[model samples]
Structures are given as C-alpha cells and as structure tokens.
Target: MSGFSSFWASQNKVFRISIILLLLASITYGQGNRKPFAIEGKLNLTSWDIDQNPIELNGDWFFYWNQILTPQDGLLSFNQENKNIKSFPGLWTDYEGDTSYPSFGFASYLLIIEGLEKDKEYALKVPDMYCSYQLWVGSKLVASNGKIGRDAESYEPEWRPVTVNFVAERETESILLNISNFDHSKGGIKNSIVLGPVEHLASQKTNEVAANLIRIIGIALISIISLAGFFLYSKKLFTYFSIFSILWSVRGIFSNMYLIYSWIPDFNWTLGTKIEYLTIYTSVLVGYHIFHNLFPNHSNKIISWASIFINSTFIIITLVSPAVMFTELLNIYFGLMGLLLAYILINVIQAYIYDEKGAGYLAVAITLIIILFFYDMLSYYKFLPYNPYITSIGYVILYGLLGYTLRYNQLHKSKDTTFKFS
Candidate 1:
C-alpha cells in the first residue's frame, strides 16, 4: 500500500490532468442543454390568487456596473494602492469595531420578477452584515442595511429575510438594486450572499462557464460508467448494478428531460422544482450503495445501520409533510454524500499505502468526482457562484466504482474458471 501511494504521488501531475480532461470531456459531450427554456407545466395554476404569493426574486439576478451585467464574483477589489483583488455578495468587516466585517467594492444587482401579488408585503433581507447596506425596490428605498455597531449581535447578517412590504401598483414587475461596498478600510474584503425570492423559483441558470462545463462532464462520465457496468456483469455485479442503475435512472428521469415530458405532462411550474428535490432524496440511497461498495468492511452491520438511519429519517420527513423536509433533507443528503465520498477516498488512500494495484486509479476518479460534487453542492445552496445546471459528478463516480467492482469480480471469475479447467 505504501509503495502504491508513493507511485500515485509521483504521477500526481499526469493523473490530475487526465482526470480533469475526462471530466471536461464528459460535460462537453453528455449534458448539452437540450431545452434552453422548456416549461415543465407544473406552474399551470388555475387562479391568479395562488400565484400571487410573494415569490423570492433571487433567481437569475444580474449584476450591472457602469451599464454592464457582470458575472458572479465580477467585482474587482482593490487596496489603497488600487490593485485588483476578489469580491462577492455578503457583509464584510473593515477591521473596525470589535468584530469587523469583510470589505468589497460596489456592485448593483437586478432581479426579474413574475407572478407577484399586489397589495402584499415582501422583504428584501440580507441576513446580517454587522456593517452597512442599502436595498431598493424598483428604485425605492425599502430598507437600507444601515451601519450597526459590531458589539450588537443583531448587527451581523442573520440567515433571515429582511422584510419589505409593498403595494404593487401593477401586475408584472422587476427589481433594480444597488449595493455599495464601503469597506475600503477593512483588510482584503469580499461579499458572497444569496438574493432570495419569496418562494424558491426554478433555479436560475448560472452563467458560470466553468461550472457548466463541469456539469456536462459529470453527465458524460455517468453515462459511460452506466454502460461499463452493463457490459461487464457477473451475478453479484449485475445485482448491485441493477439496483444502482435503476435508482439513478429513475432519478435521472425526474431530473433529465425525459421524465418531465413523460410522467407529469400537465406540469405545474413547481413540479419540476419538486422533482429536483426528490432527486436529492433518492441520491442519498445511491450514496449508501456507493460507500458500501468502495469501503467494504468485514462486517456489513455498520452499513446496514447507516442505510436504515437514512431511510428512516427520509420516511419520517415525508410523513410530516414534504415542505418540512425540503431544506433539511438537502442538508442530510449533502452531509451523507460527503461522508460517503470521504470514506471511499480514505479507503483508496489506504489501498495505495498498502501497495494495491488499482488504488491509484480509484483515487484519481474520486478526486475528480469530489471537485465536481463540491461545486454542485455549493451552487445548490447558492454558496458557490454557479449556474443552475447541477453537475452529476458524484453519480458518475458512484457508477464508475460500481463498474470497476463488477469488472474485477468477472475477471476474477474467469481466471478461476481457467485454472479449474486446466
């Protein structure tokens, strides 16, 4: 294992390049945007009243500076010397008061809104900034994130909406926003905050070209791994692959275009959104299998327990009401997937340390998957700057691991058969 690990360490450069190229190729070829704008039909509500609920205007918000819409992290920060640095959408301390926030340059954001209720209250909240901010509703100052003392706990941006009640004089509308960065005195400042819609809208497509490429790559890898498993199947391999493939295939149906058009023909606008959540739920089970395969322990007891725990939790949330589980389930799946991936990587590392032949390949594969997974996870919660094209990198890794296992088992069987015949 040590020898194998050393070998991988020596070839890290080559492995990294290959994995990155493979990931890029997958995204480019497999997950091309088939429908730039396909209505899932889920939002076909009968009444103007239901649609009138305050929807969060967070999705597809654009940043405009000097009359140009800037991409995510487009603000170039500068010091007193005026050198360019990085910036984003959140509160930052200027190394002032006891707890200063990060500083950033000025940037304006605009959100396009549809189906908003008139004569209703809506809040444009930035959780906490501990500093200063200004909010505008169509050029009207709704609430300014005014400067607050760092000593005040409420001064920080809390993960809550800053409410703004308004009487919409007209039916359809949009919001123009201007946020100033006054943290010049603060040391090396950046902002990264999520602009929220009242209700979660269809994930706004991100204009991040790198992230989109990652998604396409993930999809292609998943397709290849799925095919790989199908081609090399022994009894055990077939059983596992059957379960894995069916689960993801069903999940893909809910996620990809095929299911949207077939199953829920009369889609409510929210149906597609709902299916996206469901895909996360099912992917938890998929993670369980991936972990079990990659980090096989002498005893299956722990894996069984973990599976039960995950399913039980999901079942309980579903029983309580789906909405209760929305954010919570996402968090759960995210944590579980992370743990599974970590365990697999650890096993691969251990295998390499023990001089195992295939551990290096597995490690490279896991590394690529993790890179893609982190981007998707961050994008899902709006933590990372990305477009809504969710990358399927983790799924690709899981299927690849499954395929490798099946292939290894079949080869072992063939070798054993040859020995016996001889």
Candidate 2:
C-alpha cells in the first residue's frame, strides 16, 4: 500500500495535467467559435463573413408550441397569444413558458436571418432533430427528414443530417421548420443548425463525415486486431476487448453522423436505436469482464454475477420493448455504470498496488474513461454544455493507452520466458 501511495503521488501531477489538457481540448474542438446568435427568431449577420465562420443558428427562435405552421400559412397567421420564444440546441421538455411542453409533441420553429447579401450562394446545415422535420426557406420547401406528423401513427422518424444550398433572393430570409416527435423521449431541435456559405458548409460537412469515418474505421481495425489476437493467443482478455471494440464501432455507425442510415437509406430507425443502446450496455459489461480477467483475485464473484444479471436484463428489455420504453432506462443505466466503474477502478488500484504488469497503464486508461463517461452523462442530461465529437476524442486516448498496455505486457512476458529458459 505504501509503495502504491508513493507511485501514485509521483505520477499524480502528470495524470491530472494530461486529463486537464484532454478536457480542455474536448471542450474547445468544433464549437463553431461564433459569438453571434439568433434573438427572438431574428439573427443579424451583416458584418459576419459566412466563409470565415459558419454560425450556429442557436438561441431564441419563434416557437409555436403544439402548432405545426407552414410557409403557406404565413408566420403572422399564428395566434399572437399562443406565440412563444424557445431556445434551440435544446429539447422542448426544458421549455418553461406560457404552458408546459411535453417531450412528445409537434411544433414549428421560425428563424428570420437579416443582412445577407442578395442572391449570394449560402447553405444551411440541418442536423437530425428528435424525430422528423420539414424546413422551408421563403415559401420554398428545401429539405425534410422523414414525414412530420401531428400524431404518432402519421409520424415517421428518420435521422439524416443534411446541408441545403440556396441563393439568398433577398437581404432577409424566413426559415420555418415543422418538427414533430412521438417515437423518442426527447423532442425538438437538440443539435445546432448551422448557416454559412455554400462552399464552407460543404467543406465542413465533408470534414465531419471524414472524421466520423476515420473514427469508425479505427475502432473496426482495433476490433479486428483484437479478434485475431484472441484466435492466435486464445486469451479471454483479447476476446472481451474485441467485443467491446466491435460494439463501439456499431454504436459509432448509428450515432454521431448516423453513417449507417446514410449508407443504407432504408435502415430501420428503431432497430438502429436498439443496437446503439445494446452496444452501450454490452460494452460496459464486456469492460467489466476485461477488468475482472486482469485481476481476478480483486474481483468479487457475487458482484460480478449480479452485474451480469443486471446487464442481461437491460439487454433483454431493450430487445423486447419499444424505443421510448427502453430509452428511459438510460438514466438508471448510467447510475449503475458509475457504480460498476468505481468497483473496477478499486480492483485496478489493487492490481497496481501488487505491481501487476501493465496495471499502471490500465489504471490511467480507466481513470480517463471514467472522467469522460461522467462528462458525457452530464452533457446528455443538459447539466453541462455538450461538445460534439468529444466521445471520439476520449475513445482515441483510452484505446491508445490500452493498446500500449497490451504491447507492454506481451513484451514483458516474452522477456520473462526468455529469462526462465536461460
């Protein structure tokens, strides 16, 4: 224990510094870095250059709760008394205005952009909303995702991030969106809708797609390598890690950019969502097994079995139930995962205390994973501001450390064998 204490004390500063740097990088990356935002459905960007900085169409937009208005209806046709202002990049459930808004409902969002050069080629980057949405630019229906309906039966949920290009016919433009949600727990535009020059938006979308592809490819490569390692070496650790990597890769396809749907346009939404949730639940389960295998003496058998039971139950629930029913279990699952990680960390510490091979590296990786996990959880619940692609950053760092640890262990084992023979 004294040895462990001294070792941790010596490395504490370095670890904290590394984590802080990572956190800062994650917070700052891909944040648009624009201060200008919409106010009461109007954004003035006369001075701003769209080519230089694509603005996130965030902030207060003219929200018509429970009313799905169209460009044909005219923005002014809505009841003045029912007019409400709601902030974007957030769910309607968070709205606290004239009337309380439920998670599942239909609404219209209107944002008027002023001070644009007439007839200039510009683009709007529309992210995947809660379920389905239709966008209109000055009475022209430019883009839509799935079919937006007032009720569940008529609603068809689809997730496809789109970049729509248009020529600014006038100096001011009215952007109207009719969005509906009945399939998911959260509704409304939760992600930023970006507005910028056509070329810039296209470049940005290309870069984003490229990054997501790289991440998915990297994870898939790890899984393949781990699987090969398992087959060659017949190690349980390799098998578990391979499963973890594979699950995350599938999750990456469904999440972030929803690349799978892009590749297969007719992919089922509910199935994709189910796979996403299953991957998360199973990845943690596999992660626990990895830790248990590393330091079996430190792992409690009863606790391990209990965890298995709980994760199995969650997996079963996800498979059998509707998306709405299974999605609500995420908060509870996050709490359980926190506890599970704590236990795993304690075992890793024990392994480190005994001077187990590669334990130090494992400890560092797990610590970072826990930090990122909490950050993601808080961001998901809106307790903290969310950062796009932050999880991918965390995964890159975590997997790098894990890969190094694996290599270190293998090298040391070979050396030990050679020494024994000598």
Candidate 3:
C-alpha cells in the first residue's frame, strides 16, 4: 500500500486540458456574400427579439494544416488557398482533402461573414475547441485561449470556451482564426457556435460560471463528509473510500473547463488531465482494495495483486502517452469496470443471502451503482445525450454503506459475546 501511494505521488506531473463544448444547433441559410474558399454563413441581425433565438454560424471555412502563424506569416499562402476550405464545427482531420488524417501541428480557419449592421454590438460564442486558438475579427485580434505551441514538445492542451464580443466596425467582416491542437485525435470546433445579441452571450456566460461553482462546492462537501467517516472509523474500507471521494472532488474542480481556464488561463491542460485521469485510476485501485478487504474469501492475494498490476501499468502508459492515444483505451477502462462490478455483485448477493448485517444496504447500493454505470457507459459512447457523472454519485453511496457495514460488524461481535456470557 505504501508503494502504491508512492506511485500516485509520482504522477503529480500530470495535467489535463479540454474546454466547454457549446451545444450544436441547426443553421438557417439566409442572404450572405462569400469569397472563394471562405464560408458565407448567414449572420442574421434583423431580429433583436429576445425570443428570436441565436443563429448558428455554419459553412465551409478555410482550413490550413500543421501551420499556426500570424495572418501575415504567409503573404502568398493565404491567397493561394482559395479552394482549400473545411466545413465549420468539424475537425480538419475528418475533412476530405489531399492532406492526410491526424496532421499534428498548427492550423487556421478563415471565414468571411458579410452583411452586418454598422456600429451594432454582436457576440460570437466559441464552442468547445481542442488544444488552443486565437480569434481575429477583421484586422483586430479579439481573443485567444489556452497555450498554442508550434510542436509536440511545446504543445499542451487546455480547453476553455471564449465569447468574443465586437462592434461591427463595417458591414463586412472577415474572421481569421488560428488554431493548434496536438492533444486529441481530431481537432477543431466539436460543438456548434452561436452568434447573436451581446446580452444573450453575457447571460450564457453567467449561467456557466454559476453551474461550475455549484458543482465544485457540492463535490467539496462530499469529500469532507467522507473524510470525517475515514477518521472516525479508522478502518481500511473507510480510508480507501475517503481517498476515492477526495479524488472525485479534485476531478470536479477541473471538470468545468471555462472556470478552470479563467483561473489558470496559461496553466497546462495536459497536466490537469494527467491529474484527472490519475485520480480516476487511483480511485479504482483503492476501490478494489476495499472490496478485497470486505470480501477476502472471494478475492485472494492473487486477485489483489493482478488488479494493482493492471491499473499501475495503465497509469504509467497514460502518463507517457498523448491524449489521443489515451482516449482510445477508455473502452478498456469500461471493461475493467464491468468485471469489478460483476465480482462485487456476486459477493454482495452472497452476503445478503447469509443474513449478514448491513448486507441489505450494501446490496442495494451496488445494484444502483451497476445501473448508473450502465447509463454512464451509454452516455460515454454517445448512445445518450446526458453526461451523468454517475460514478461520483455511486461512490458516495458506496462509501456510506461501507461505513454502516463496519459499525454493524463491530456491534454483531459485541452482541455475540454478551449472549455467550449470559
């Protein structure tokens, strides 16, 4: 266990990156002008009605591969790419072209949106984008997010949504966006972008920030609760569960991309991600340890050692690999989860059938967890739209059940001695 703790301590170097992905919406085509290779999406400004809803900026935009430079970096390169266009709200890696997939470097997207009211305030909500990006409306640079490195060694992914508000200086605007992503497999705007009134954008930002704060506070409370149990019980199950709770609380802190990026704007998202995944893996390790302790007969030393070995190897691989490769192994994590749940289910049922104290609550808890795990797995595979962090919720219940079981066992032993002596 000491060695295991030391291994986790060594993973302090890991960081993570990802940003708030705005929901995808449909686009309505309207009158707009276009240039060769530039997307001419309709940025309708006719309606100021609060109920009018936002307009989705969709169409093919200029796409450059493995090159993140200033707009003037290529005096001749910009003009020559008249036919090179990639659709908006899609990754360049998925775009069909002469260029190969997974182009690992810098890229730029150029969109020319014409027909806008002069001197009117407008806001463009950037969707969850991979790696980093810089937005230039006309000749003025409006915003930049995360660290944009020229190459792999310099590249660290940190994701955050940014709202760019600008007054229409002219009736026509050419938006030049320089983006770079070496973190994930496909990189670009994965979510739909909204463009509309500045007020609406501000309201949206406020809601996002509020949600993040609430989530962090709630997770912090859970950690505190579990910590109290750990200290009061001084049992292995309670200690492991406490560690798991704290890890999840840490995950919640970094879960909201927008707030985190705001606080640590320049901090490496990759490092954050490493910490995130490390917590996840570590939780599972300690989780199995708790199970093995509670049901020692069902899981022996061999089973214990195997679980440790497998997770330890995965953690090492995760620390060394890029985000793209690591994501591919997520299914494996799911599979291991399924195995653990099956084992726990069997043992929990056996305990219940034998009339063990607190086994009933433990049974109910594990059953609910299995159901939540199923739903979360579906959400993970895009089978469901709701991204329920059920694991966190499930663990909270499990921790409480274990606490009850520990106390119940102690009372059961005390009652037996009293009966025998009488």
Candidate 4:
C-alpha cells in the first residue's frame, strides 16, 4: 500500500506538471506576436512586422450578401456604403446585418490590406470554407476550391485547404472572395485566412502536415500492436482498444489536415463526411466497451447498453443519410456523448477508489479526453479560438498512458503466474 501510494504520488506530480506545461504552451501559442485585426474591411499593417508571425485576417470585412461579386464588379460598382460589414471566420447563418441570413446562400467578401511591402512575396493560407469558393488578389484569381455558383444547381461543393503565394504589386492590396454553399448546413468562411511571409507560411504548412502524418502513423502503430496483442492473448480489452484506435486513426485522416484528400484528390466529399461521423460514433461505442471491460464492477450495465444502442443507431444513420442531414445530428450526439463520458469518468473514479488495477492511470487519461473533447466542441462552434493540434496532442498523450497501463497489468499478471508456478 505504501509503495503504491508513493508511486501514485510521483505520477500525480508528473501529471500536474504536464498539464501546467500544456496550458502554458497553449496560451503562449495563442498569443504569438499578436497584431491588429481588420476593421470595417481594412487592415493596416504598415508598422507591423511580417517576420514575426502569420496574421489571421479576422475582424470585419465587406460582405455582400447574396451577391457573387467579382473584383471588377466590386471595384467599379460597389462603394463603402454599398457593402455590409460582417466578421470573418464566421458563417453567414449568423450574419444579422440588414436582415437574417440562412446557412444556404451565396456571398462575396472583400478585404483591403494596407501597408504591405511592395514587390515582396507573401503567402495566404485559406482554410476549408463551407462548400465552394474562389479568391482573387487584385483582379487576378489566385486560388479556388471546388466550383462556385449562385445557386444549388450551378454550385459544386468541395472542401480543401489551400495556400496561395503572390508578390505584392503595390503598397495596398485588394482581396475578393466569392463563396457559395448549397449542399451543406453551413455557408461562408468558417476559418480565418492567414497571411505571412512566403517562407514562413510555407514552413508552417510543412510542419503542420508533418505533425499530422506523425500522429496518424503513431495511432496506426498503436492499433496494429493492440490487434496483435489481442490475437496473442485473446483479450477482449485489447480488441476493444484496437478498434477504438483504428477508428480514431481513420477519423484523423479525414479531419484536421484532411490528409486523405491529398492521396485521393477526387474522393467524394459526401462519403468523406459520412466516414468522419461514423468514425466518431463507432469510437464511442468501442471506447465505452473498453472501460466496461476494465471495470465491470463499477460500470453500469444499463448505461453501457444504452450507449451501445445509441451509438449503433447513429452509425447507421450516418452511413445512410446525406451529409447535410447527418451533420446536424453532431450537436445532439455531442450532448449525449458528454453524458456518457461523465458516466465513464464516474466509473473510473470508483474503480480508483477501490484500488482497481490501472484505474489511476486511466482516470487521468479519461479526464484529459473529456477536457480535449469540450475544447474541440467549443472550437468547432466558433465559441473559442481554434487550435488545430490540441486534440491530436491530447490523444497522443492518452494512448501513451493507456499503453503504460496495459504493460503494467501484463507485467503484474506475469509475476502472479510465476508465483503460482513456484
């Protein structure tokens, strides 16, 4: 008992330090050399240094609702009074300038960037918008994803993050974005556009892709090892965890950097969206089974069965329904999953109180998962600032802890077998 206490005490200290470091890092990264945002469609960066960090082109921008205006049209026809100011990195559904806007519609966004170094090369990182978009930098169409149109028949929806590089032709530049969404529940720019030095933005993109690749590779390895362990030992715990990890790996590929699209550029967006949702649903089912198996005495059978049934139903709906329909169910799923996670947390805590093997480690892992889950939800809904890599970081730490707990259990079981034989 004393040895266990001592071990747990050391682990607790390590866990606390790790959490503190993670929070400090998040804060530091979130506030990295902040710059002023655009106000009423203009961003002044004359005195701001571009070498410091990439700037998110957030704040108010000239929004022309229901009008797919081009650079020529905007320059010749529209003036300051003709435009409506709307915040960037937000959906048109939330736009309430002159009137309410629905999720489906076409719109044009314009932002004039002032004080750029003339003739210097810069890069703009455009995130995945709702359905389709075309971007023009000073009358030259620089980059586009999918096909943009004024309505559903003419519009084609595609989602891909792109970085455009162009030289600054003048001290001030104009950016025009024509976006249209007819197939999804949300429309308009969903994420901030990033601008920085060409080399800096390029390096940043490379680092992000590399990090995502590493995480996917790591999760894939864990799934493979867990499956091999299951086959060798015939343990249901290993099987459950293996499935859980595999689902997460699939989800990871489809999300964050959308790495799968790089490999299959023509992959169907609807199918990809379904796979994303199905992975989440199935992961919860498998994850709950893992905990129930680990602490059967503490886990409630009713809740376990209920989770299984609900998740299974969700999986079926996601597989059959269209992206627009199934995507709306995600918020409801999150609410249910939150309750399920709370139940699992309570069970883990009970197991730890009763000194169940590996409970302490698992409790910590589950706690971290809960925190990251909420963080991701808030971030997704635009309630909080986006951090693309935090959830991946949390999952990596979770897998490490689970791996340690599994090894610890195996080692102790081997000792028990040896003692019995002796």
Q: How much lDDT does each candidate structure score?
A: 0.43, 0.79, 0.64, 0.79
Q: Name the 10 consecutive residues with the lowest summed lDDT in model 1.
A: 35-44
Q: How many backbone clashes does candidate 3 have?
A: 15
Candidate 3 residue-wise lDDT, 1-422, digit = tens: 99977876666443211111212111111121221222343243343332245555667666666666564653335567364666786876677756765746678776656667778788888865776788777767877776677887776566777777888788867677777777776677777566778987778777656555555565566556656754665533455556766776676656544455678777677777677677778878877776665555556566678778988987897899977777568778879867866777887788778876667877876777667767766554444443323444455555556556655653454332111101
Q: How close is candidate 1 to the true structure, as a TM-score?
A: 0.40
Worst 10 residues of 2 by lDDT: 413-422
lDDT of 1 by residue, 96-165 (tens): 3344333433444444344545555444433323223445454355654433222223222211124344
Q: Which ten residues in a row have the lowest lDDT in candidate 4?
A: 413-422
The C-alpha stretches of model 4 lying farther than 4 A from their native spots are 1-34, 370-394, 404-422
Runs of candidate 1 with Cα error greater than 4 angstroms are 1-232, 242-274, 290-295, 298-300, 352-358, 373-402, 413-422
- C-alpha lDDT (0 to 100) for residue 351 of candidate 4: 85
lDDT of 2 by residue, 1-422 (tens): 99988877788677979778678766654353446788877889888877787788888788777888878564674335555777886788777756777878998888888888888888999999889999998878888998899899998999989999988889988888899999887888877888888887788788778767666877888878877875666554676678888888888899888988789989999998899899988987887766665556678888888788989999999999988789878999989877887878887898899998889999899788778878988775444655545766678667767766765665455332221100
Task: Point to the candidate with the largest TM-score.
Answer: 4
- Please give the lDDT score at residue 40 for candidate 2: 70
Ranking the candidates on lDDT from highest down gives 2, 4, 3, 1
lDDT of 4 at 79: 64
Worst 10 residues of 3 by lDDT: 22-31
lDDT of 3 at 221: 62
Instruction: Report the Cα RMSD per candidate.
Output: 16.8, 7.1, 13.5, 7.2
